[model samples]
Target: MSDEDIAPGSDVEQEVLDDEPKSILLGIIGQLRKGGDLSRVTLPTFVLEPRSMTERITDFMSHPELINNAPLNTDPVGRFADVVAYFLSGWHIKPKGVKKPYNPVLGEFFRCRWDFEDGSTAYYVCEQVSHHPPVSVYFYANPQNDIWISGHVRPASKFLGNSAATLMRGTHHVQFKRSWPGEEYTVTLPNVYARGILFGSMYLELGDSVVLKCPKNDLVADIDFQTKGFFTGVYNGVKGRIKRESSGEVIYNIAGKWTDSIQFTKASTSEKKTVFNAATAQIHTKVPPAEDAQEEFEARKLWERVTKGITTKNLDYATKEKTAIEDNQRVILKERAAKGVTWQPRFFTGPVDDDWSFGLKE
Candidate 1:
């Protein structure tokens, strides 16, 4: 069976059919709206999903085909368009209305890999590098395709009456090994939102504009994520165009739904082709089991008990463990601060910089 066929469930998923958790979440929103920080608020463990944010970090790898053959394209401009399709593939991994994922503890990290059918492995690593601004640093590399992605996200979220909007402040660095003098493309992230939170109909929508640009190739893709409108609109709408960076002349027109497929049309011939198909796509995010993962770098190992408590509907156990973990992280931060020691990311050198060098060539 494929990895996507496996749902996020444990022996405990069956026990979490109660509706009492919604009231607790609603109360937090009222407090947060009054200038209370989301980071400082203590969320009820009953609302926790069975997975960790570190596990959700692997969602980008859900579309392996898009990234695998992108670097093989001879036309750097066309390749940039394919990369844009790839960047759009990470959304809508789960059905809407699910509870929020467990926030990663400070110093928490996750490591996993996907072995492609072509014998290439897509390796991924994510670290919760900051707590105050809630920054997550991630690295994805596929040795076979000679493609590497590195980025860090510092998300600023606000409750906009009925919906919560998160503006992602980050740039995804995509590098290829094929042609164009070893060029790199910077891919911007789309805005995230959860709609109908105030009236009880909760669904996700990715909105706003995102750009993908390759300076060396003079290629650019302008993508617009459209949200569902009040009277007449569809959910998960997306539209875009690919153009030359110098002349601003569109080479291709792109459009599709985020929950289904994306198509690109050539401006010259008006021939349209589907670039990505989500309904038929499958992804494999391989992480070691809790029993086998390394002590420090393992996501499953660190959150095993909490995961068990969540899955088994043991709220008391889950809440107790979650509190303990957060408390320990605070104590560790204090000790490190007292000694004038600063914690550094293991892979990312300058997590805050615009151009973070991988030193792959260095």
Candidate 2:
């Protein structure tokens, strides 16, 4: 191939430069498109309703391990509700006065407190009404002084639609040490949802940031996580909280109900580190830690080639000029080459241009 075809500034180079960015952007979109595969993945649609003790007992048989040492195992829903009732029973809230509906699938419970006196209540104050459920539940306090208790059960669909996913934004910082081993590393980040309740099965967005310093350089990085699952409503709901813009209400929010931290670190490996030149950049001789033999060898070879070429070119140019002065004029011509070589020819003569002054007052 010609030099035009193979060199850095060639047409091929320009074409590659133009297409590289588009190719990378398309590659990223391809990975995000994998979310479409969720169509084949089955997800349970929760139907929340009240159930009796007998029904809770039937459901317990299906998952016996869930209620091995617990009290009340009459029906599926009732058994689960009874378990919840036990936890709440410790509180002074009357069960009948509570009149709240619970959903097992979403792991949530709702109840109304007619009046809670801090004098008798150990957990909360008299003015504060408690509404904590199993996994994800919202409770609002009533300001009116004690007598009537009332609340409603509504689909979480309104609160948990597109808005829930958007409200789930976060950032974290992590440091990497060079002495750290392993190509794959895990940094236990503080749970992003530091203040939300675990609602039923919901989608969560997990993100991370890593800051690294090497020599004099530093950098930042990010990663994304997503998935779905049942919020046990127990300890492991990935709990957190955020303020609601629409209703101006603050509730215990759930960050991640379904997914765990599996594929959390999905970022390019190169961004995790920074590289800089080491001091004592190049060596001339090797004694011990002071100098490197390989660098010395490479430097010596480079200088030898460069000086040798300069000497050889000067000798060749002199020979050419000597032959050119044969018989035409017996003149010594001093000319400069296009490559910046200052050529001075020595002829069978004495002082060339000092004798003839071009009308200049020296």
Q: lDDT for each of the candidates?
A: 0.73, 0.21
RMSD of each: 6.0, 38.4
Per-residue lDDT for 14-117 in model 1, tens only?
Answer: 12223566666787787766323455567788646677777775777788788788877887776887788888887857633535677777767777778888
Off by over 4 Å in 1: 1-19, 34-37, 355-362
Clashes of 2: 25
Per-residue lDDT tens digits for candidate 2, residues 1-362, read 12232335311111111244334423433443322321111111111112211112121112112222222233322232222212111111112111112222211121112222322110111110111211121212122211111111111211221112112111111111122212111112211221111212111232222211111111111112222223322222233222233443322222322122111111323122111111211111111112233232122221233223334544344334323322211232122234565332111111122111111122
Q: Summing lDDT over every window of 10 consecutive residues in candidate 1, give the lowest-scoring window.
A: 9-18
Top-lDDT structure, candidate number: 1
Instruction: Spell out the clash pairs found in candidate 1.
Output: 12-311, 12-312
* Per-residue lDDT value at 151 in model 2: 17
